[model samples]
Target: MRILQQMNAFCVMTLIAFSISASVQAESPAPVQAAKKALAVGQTAKDFQLLSVGGELSGEVKLSDVNADGKVVVVVLRGFPGKQCPACSAQVGDFVKNASKFAAKNAKVLLVYPGPKSQLDQRADEFLQGTKLPAPLTFLLDPGYTFTNAYGLRWDAPRETAYPTTLVLDESGKIQFVKISETHRGRSSAAEVLEAL
Candidate 1:
């Protein structure tokens, strides 16, 4: 009888151990390396259509449509991350300040604002309250990190959003230049982007 009881207890313990392991696996997300490969310079850029929550281009913006027009595209922005990011503001400001220069090169700049799906539009609108986007430079919404994940730029950390990413795509949707900042401090400057163009 004692041996029988010991066997049952061992079975229970094994079940408990399996349950704990399963719970841990369920709670942990896949490592960043497991994500889709990020786009590289010279690769054909993936086309995405995200909503224009705010800015000069306030509607659905399609990347393919822009590429078809023989225009270069510059996409780089840290989407809303529970609040306005100062670095993002500065990066976007630089682009907005150079909007005329981008237009002169027939380039369209798309600044992506990514965040959770809940209240995303409201947050995007709030983020744009004080800024003005000129022609050929627009703000886009990446609700629930859809675009961020698709582009392999989701930061996926506590209080973090997408990685600060800059891509310059040629008229054929090929990436002419790309910069994926490992940290918030290395964002590509407007001048560098123009030079890439």
Candidate 2:
């Protein structure tokens, strides 16, 4: 009976091992994802003018002022009509819930919404409707996706939209941290981003 148990365990181990090896062999090899062109750590973040419900977006918020005063958290959002983007809405809600935590860390948050200029105003307002954003958080719009192109966060899929990403820029406007998602599922959380800071 003892030998039978040992054989069973050995067979289980061997099966797992063979299954893993076969899976690896049968899988189509994936090419290495090219290093995407975007702001890297220690690189200076560029500036641009954005269309906003509040008027005067983009270059208005300087990275230097942010770094010299406190930290800057820039969250990018995919525009409206791009699958409802429940993930993005949830992400912003979560961050707004923890807005104070970011303030305690001396960071100002800017949410960047990118869409075509014609629809930017309406779409941006839809995202900010009735949401009590703390004073520290500013919602900015990228009309015509100039900022997306400049920041290298444009997603070129047929039915896709801009890349939903997060960037932490220092006082001098240099990127202290950056996170860009290829898929639509991920945009950094407030806790996750604060920890990065």
Candidate achieving the largest TM-score: 1
**Tens-digit lDDT track of model 2 for 1-197:** 99999999999999999999999877522321221344778877776655444421334655455456767888888877454578888998888888788878878888888877786677777777756677567787777878877776767667666777899887678788887776777678888899987
Give candidate 1's TM-score. Answer: 0.78
**Residue range 1-197, candidate 1, lDDT tens digits:** 99999999999999999999999766524433333244766788778888875565778988898678766655556666666788888888888889899988988888888888988878777778866678888788888888887777788888788778788888888888877776677889899999999
Scored by lDDT, model 1 comes in at 0.78
Kindly report which residue stretches of model 2 are placed more than 4 angstroms away from their true locations once superposed. Answer: 1-37, 54-68
The candidate 1 region of ten consecutive residues with least summed lDDT is 28-37
- Judge candidate 2 against the unseen true structure and give its global Cα lDDT, from 0 to 1: 0.73
Off by over 4 Å in 1: 1-37
TM-scores for all candidates? Answer: 0.78, 0.75
State candidate 2's TM-score.
0.75
